[model samples]
Target chain A: MEKADHLSMKDEPEVQGEPTKTAVHLSTKDRPKVPGEPTKTGTSMVDTAAAAVQSFAPLNQIHQHLCAFHFYAYDMTRQVEAHHFCSHINEDMRQCLIYDGPDPNARLIGLEYMVTEKLFMTLPDDEKKLWHTHEWEVKGGFLFMPGVPEVMQRQDLEKVAKTYGKVFHFWQVELGHELPIGLPNLMMAVTRDGQLYPEMIKETEKQFGISIEKERESRAYMKGPEHGIHPLANGGGKGLKLELREVDIKPVESVPRVFV
Target chain B: MASSGDEDQVPPGDPVTVSTLVIDAGTKIMQRRLPVKQMNTHVSTFAIYGGDMSRQIETHHYIHRVNDEFLQCAVFASDHSDAPLIGIEYVISDRLYENLPQDEQKLWHSHAYEVKSGSWAYPRLPEVVASPELKNIAKTYGKFWCTWQIDRGDKLPMGAPELMMSPQGVGQGVLRPELVKRRDEKYNISTDELKQRRAEIAEPEWINPMADYWKQHGKCFVLDIVTVEMNRNEKFP
Candidate 1:
């Protein structure tokens, strides 16, 4: 089986055929001459000028190899609703989009993070306190990659279960508001059963039409020595003791903004 | 349907987005010959200090290769399409920052305040996407230098490479609102609101020791021809 290509050029070269001399004559007659500029003949000259302008068009460069994953996150401050569709940025760093629903017109509500254990371990002890491990999300079947085969999903989950993520929601879609309002609030995933409103997860499962019990059962293979939490994860570190709490840190709302 | 075990059965494009035709990772795509302007999401504006420390030049940075061991950012005068390229800031991981010699390390600045304070943000992206990028950026240290002082109205890059650094503390009045206002007007966010949000993020106790050394020393030395010439004249006179 051939592997799928990830980076194929979208543009194909244009084939040049015979150029008519009549077209060149007509173009020269129609073109307005600029003051003190030499009159140009030949379609080749015109084509070169057109090509020069075309070269200036914005070229889209593939900056990084990207892959997408889905996530289920709940607001840490509110702790009522679970948002869906969190995506990752380079497969290693998780960047999830918080949408209102599964529909195409779903409102983009917030963003979340999933970092590899390797990256998470390097964060300072203070920063680590802001992030949460995916153990409960994985073990409880609350988090699962959608659309992929069960085998592939299991493989992805094994990698995901070993990582940590931080979530922040700018739009609180759960309050029945039509638009995202207020400042961005830091969000958290349920690290334990009964921590979040159980009904919210059930509602999310119903909306997505997936059973958490079955998802959890399928991910049983991800358990064991390979998926154990990193020491630095869950706010645990050498010589530093910190407890994860649901405190609202409002001072972050004051960070100065600059237009980019 | 073909068995999932067959790798070829997995289609040629991304399963989610059908319009985007992709080559397999194994296929080598030609590097873009044309100068490509990719929109780097995590772009932040910095008031870089010069070698003399009195000169503060505003710079816009578009960060790339962020997930890699070394993060690279292209400095621009503005976020506009025609914004001139002024410089580059190369950030390395703490592991790499630690290995640099004392003299070399003095050039880099700690991102703890920049990240924690919300000074560094994804310019045009939604909050959901920008937050994690900022989180990832907080972990690294950057060494920035600007060749073009676009703020000073130099049509082209002139003079020696000026040392660049992020603001050390919040509300230090280091970041100019006039410059930040132009950026906020472009992005549709108030700089005051961002300043308010930044205050909530706790400052990290552990900062890059290199940044600490430079802070105490109160000067950044850049080897430049202009400085050498001036020093030579002083010695000769």
Candidate 2:
């Protein structure tokens, strides 16, 4: 099958091109009228994000790449109601993979993550077996950011572990020659009980030492009869295509001794 | 096939009867669009923003402030990439559009969009002011979070005050009986002429498109407001 033509335009990010020689600073006063022009925080940021996507793209394309490399693999079995698992799937963050095809022949069509008041429980024997598993066998595909770095003087990682019970790892994926700043290794955690995957920012702060300013969350919705297709295909095309809603959060300056 | 009222549903280009009475009403508008350092939605969808065609499109609730009769009127959905979405268009009374601050103009470009197809266009208005009852309806139910579609009993004319009063009008106007007399008697201005001036002063490019469903049903006019809680992301108060 010929791949969709529009796919290239959608997938090819502007950052993929060779770095522009001209620098573009975007201070509030000097910012251009253009709404979403790329920032000139130097090439490192661009190169890193591009590299992350490049690495992720291929790995994601091959479902068993990790398994072929000896990583333990499991097909997302049937989707029962949201249940708590000690692994990546949990009550607060229940996710199931929807395959476009029923078997290996089909690609992953969509992923649904749900968080609600209902909580899922786990069995003690199952928890023990999962805990004994080695690091080499476990592999996950996701985007991560470090919460605190390992070298930070405050030992923020320890604080995070104490505040939000933790069980996960962190890594900085190098994209070719460039060491991206914001696109550094992700700080992530997989729960023994599938729940809110606590972002591992504490480890990031340890390495980068309090560089990030804030945390924000956003929701995206596609308007259509075809569900996911662009609106224009449905006849009600508009210049503005995407709708994103956002949430604001204040950052913690330093970890408190205790939660009030 | 059901009620006599149901039999008179609207068909495109077909003249439909509108009763003076207000029928079913609802609102569907988004609140203000805050300025964020990162416009991720724009980037993800348009692959363009802050560029030459980088126009800011802020959404807000449509309010009616006439008597204590605030209400929601209609709901709109269109794909503007084809042409501007069309709800019954109305010209706002110049007096009302002019009252809006320039900063607001900079913020809420007031254009409508059809979700299915990505298109953008300016709405044409017949007049600025709605009836005192309509204004009251908007004010009472006009929340920053919702949009509304309405049906009054009358066919919307293609002109000003009459068009605004047409089931789908969203323009503001002077409801005081005395002001109406003064503007008309002293200035010899018909409601249409006043609306012409109103459109000039306000220069509003934004208008809501009534959903095609409402248009077909022969709604007198449509009003749309978007309520905040309706947003799926609104998990907390």
Candidate 3:
């Protein structure tokens, strides 16, 4: 996990004056030209034609937008801002599309799914380690529903404060890799005070014209989990990082087919 | 600010909350964006761990084909409107799979059997368009992860995402017959008929041996969180 210190914050430029919280776009340099000449006319024409014929009902149901920050599970200091366009799979669960930013050039870097506490406590010890409690992120003022006000956001925040998320980040944007070049890495959320860089929080507050202090105060009355945070979760400050290892697929007696 | 119990204690099943009051008072979300409409194709299939076919999962994939060679999908537990989000999968052509480093190749599984066995189906799309697409997809390989192990009845997605493999070949250790029957009945289709219907899709000239390495080698890749270095002070230092 100490490999996390290798990530330098300078890779991602600061969030500037965003007129709206939903303006989660990043300020980055222009793209370098590719060898082939670009042709937008043909692309747009196909998109228009396809739209005239195709059905997009499932995608249409995705409506909620939540923007937050995720750090490489191994490194507490390295962080990336992610915008989640989510839809309810069920009342107990939510699936989201995690993008690095909201710009046209932005990359869809990861996928995160959330579940409430009643379901969370059912996980085994080892399994719990893979999930992070959202209490700190919600109660700590680091997570928000972008354009929604606190009053409207609270109903969901109350539910979220007791939930957990498992994030799989396909792109290592924090490493400054222009392309998604590596296998996915598990990502985590900040669970305690002092872990988030002071300046980073200050920049977001200034850009959005919102105060983290006031956000915490507004959510003060919201209840914390009665069971408390799991000790094995969030790497338990062990500086966790996801890595791949080869293992034998366990041999099992196959269940014979009961029907044709 | 809405005061706590300073007002009457809210009754059971109360329709009015501060949120409803705020909404009733004309608060609105002035600006918002949702860019996920790219997903269009929906296919339902089954997947099993590369190591164990005894444990199987029913998957609902809402896909967006990026180009002739690539596609990404969001996976859910079922086709039921209320199904829980389960995981994600990315499918790539043989050309891309071959170019990947040897170690990376071991992580992916071929879709040939899934297509040929009639296990993978586009339930809603017309067979005319779906047939051509299925033929092209049969030659590709996919790598997926299951976050919520609903098959185990965990109620929530737990643990790190479990890397999944598509069942290749036929019989016993491969896709189970009962599971196939269940899927067939749900969609009002016959696996045996699909097996015959898709029989004409020509098998690719070659599938990388490294792909689906476990079936032959008995080994699979797993996600781990081995502490690379101690963040705290070490005795050696």
Candidate 4:
């Protein structure tokens, strides 16, 4: 694969003497007449050099390594709905684009981020409270990597099952609001079975044409010890121990403002 | 006035107590007439952009909540009560960050590392208040661009907006000692000591890939016309 070739070639000394593309806009006639003088045109030598650096093949490898996955998420606070298309920046982090629906014209709702368990554990206890673990989401078959081979999907779930996600919903579209309004509400993943309404899951299953039971069966081997905890017991399973402390400050008048 | 050479120490005393008035419903309560609503005030420091990177400026962030979507923080350089307003930083949830256009998204920086590593802190606020605030801030992203390069000795804000980024994976030597010394004297806190305290804050194995964009691409000054103009004006060629 071209990606594999790029990775393998990373350690090798860069091959020199490659033909460099010159800016066609700057002809020989436009070159500085004097040896040490500046070019007459508005474009400086720095601009030319910057354009060269941008076209370098090595830098593009970083962009090429990105991978995408699909997931269904519900707001932890309210019964608001969301679907996510996450792009993995690396093995450690993924940035997801949340959409109201799976359709092309779906309103972009918010963003979610997933990080490895190692990274999640490094967060401060309070910050840790904001994140929801993926154990139940993966094992219960709520999260899926759509359009991949079953085996590959299983492998992806195995890795994802060990990660934690931080999500926020800007637009409360479920409330029939066309625009994003209010302070961004912190959204958490439904880590337990009963945490999410059964009807929502059924609706999602119907829309995706997949059975959650079958998904769970396919990913059964990926289940770890963490999933053994009963969802209803112990504050909704192993990793869902987040409790937001109440702020005692009085609510003041709402500030009038305009968002750029 | 505290100088860079001063060895300032934080006074050993109890935490200051704040008192609030209790008003009974039968008593008349006085209220001030205001045209607009008030915003929560937050204080922090930012290492300024300029010569040798030796300047740290105190900033007061007046945060205006725009519903549940985002907060717009008007950042002012708080050298005095009536300090000069430097810039505005719009903070949005990661959800909003994702909805932003690809090019627009590149401008925002994640605060997870900043808060967790203790690089960004609230010096005045109690730990209890600050910790939860940081926890909420951790989930969001900020787009901060300063028009003024005060540390560089710019009397007024000039040129295009220069993006402000959080310091990450930066060592003690990377910071200008004189600036740190001055800021330490003013705040009665040591950057070296803070760095030592935060030494155990392990960096996450996975960081947002774009977080390092400035570090990687910032060295290429040839792309910026302002740099070229400055270099030409200074006869650096």
Best by DockQ: 3
For each predicted model, how many residue pairs clash, with residues at least 3 apart or on different chains?
30, 133, 1, 10
Q: What is the TM-score of chain B in candidate 2?
A: 0.17
Interface RMSD of 4: 30.0
Q: A103-152 in candidate 3: lDDT tens per residue? A: 44345678887766666676677767667788878888888876677777
lDDT of 4 at A38: 28
Instruction: Give the per-residue lDDT digits (tens) of candidate 4, residues A74-191.
Output: 1222343455544333456554545455433344445565666655555555455445567777777877543344554565567677776665454444434433432233445545
Candidate 3 lDDT for residue A92: 57
Give a tens-digit lDDT track for model 1, residues A1-260: 11121111122121121111110100111212111112124322332333333222111212211112222221122332333433222344533434343333333344455566666655665566546677667767876443334554555567667777765444334333322222233444545555444444554566556787887777776652244665544323211111112122123235344435
* Candidate with more favorable, higher TM-score: 1 or 4: 1
Error of 1 at B124 (Å): 2.0
TM-score of each: 0.38, 0.18, 0.75, 0.36
Give model 1 RMSD, 1 decimal: 25.9
lDDT of 1 at B33: 15
Q: Report each candidate's C-alpha RMSD, comma-separated, in the order given.
A: 25.9, 25.7, 9.3, 26.0
Q: lDDT value for candidate 2?
A: 0.18
The TM-score obtained by chain A of candidate 2 when compared with the true chain A: 0.16
Worst 10 residues of 2 chain A by lDDT: A64-73
Off by over 4 Å in 1: A1-260, B1-31, B34-39, B52-54, B170-173, B195-202, B212-214, B226-237
Ranking by DockQ: 3, 1, 4, 2
Candidate 1 docks at the CAPRI level of incorrect
